[model samples]
Target: MRNSVLLLAMGMLLATGQPGLADDAELIKNTKADHEENGRWYTSDDIPTYKIAEDGTVDWPTFSGFRRYNAECFQCHGPDGAGGSYAPALATSVMNIDYYKFYETVVNGKQEVNAAQNLVMPALGENKNVMCYLDDIYSYLRARGTGDLGRGRPAKKEKKSEAFTENENACMGE
Candidate 1:
């Protein structure tokens, strides 16, 4: 009956080694950079994503993201968003949770406490460093989550755009 069909479908998916194939397709589509402004790339849905050159050059914002994440987030999320004893892998689920939720969570923070565990992420809404480069952080995590960018520092990166430099200065109150 229906359960048998469902089981068959699940088995087929596993056998083919394409777990969540449909989800993968959607992820690919949603993460494709449709445009760029000030050296940052965004998908058609307005979510951040990394852009890489054929010669292995990463976009500036993505590089900025790596720096920002390491500076602001790695303490809990572990190096390269790989997760740690203290936090889940942001790189693993950022894409799955989607951009809006990620933005909301980072800005407002989240807390869960119980006998088994207590988890909390402090709000970064007022942190100029994080808030200013939120998109870049998302772009970097998305790239890592999607396997588009590997761990460690990117060797080649495009020069930061003047607009990005100006915006960063303004946001940071420099």
Candidate 2:
């Protein structure tokens, strides 16, 4: 219920590209990167997000997110999350949906059937390719959703952290 409401509100805001109210920006604004753990940067809210440097260089995670997203998600979500006939535009969707809800939807999947229409998102919690890089994907979409990052590959990116590589290898069973 709450997720639906949040989605609807955010949808309207994204559609208009202007806040209907003064505080609407608050609802859509992505938080700043406050700290890092094991090579991943997170917001003060403790959720994964993106960070772009002054020189248009993106964080390693965001860059990785782009790679991972293109590797699979673009098939349904469309390149750069622009939304396809099969799936909605995730770039905007991520901004409106809270991080936890996004995780839940991606992991558990979502189903809504009605007289109006039918929508289904398959459960991907077990897809190691996606699950292992979930945070990176989220960060990439967050950057896209907030317009902090542009479409296509990033011109520059930070180097991958050792911690990230280890965790990724472990997750991938490599």
Query: How many residue pairs clash in all the candidates, one count each?
Result: 0, 0
lDDT of each: 0.88, 0.87
Clashing pairs in 1: none
Clash-forming residue pairs, model 2: none
lDDT of 2 by residue, 72-121 (tens): 68988999988988889999898777788889999999888789778788
TM-score of each: 0.82, 0.80
lDDT of 2 at 118: 84
Residue ranges of candidate 1 with Cα displaced over 4 Å: 1-29
lDDT tens string, model 1, 1-174?
A: 999999999898788865466765585447788898766788886667889888879999999999999999999999998998989999987867868788999999999889999999999999998999999999899889878899999999999999999989989999
Name the weakest run of 10 consecutive residues (lDDT summed) in model 2. 19-28
Query: Could you list the CA RMSD of all candidates, in the order they appear?
Result: 7.4, 9.8
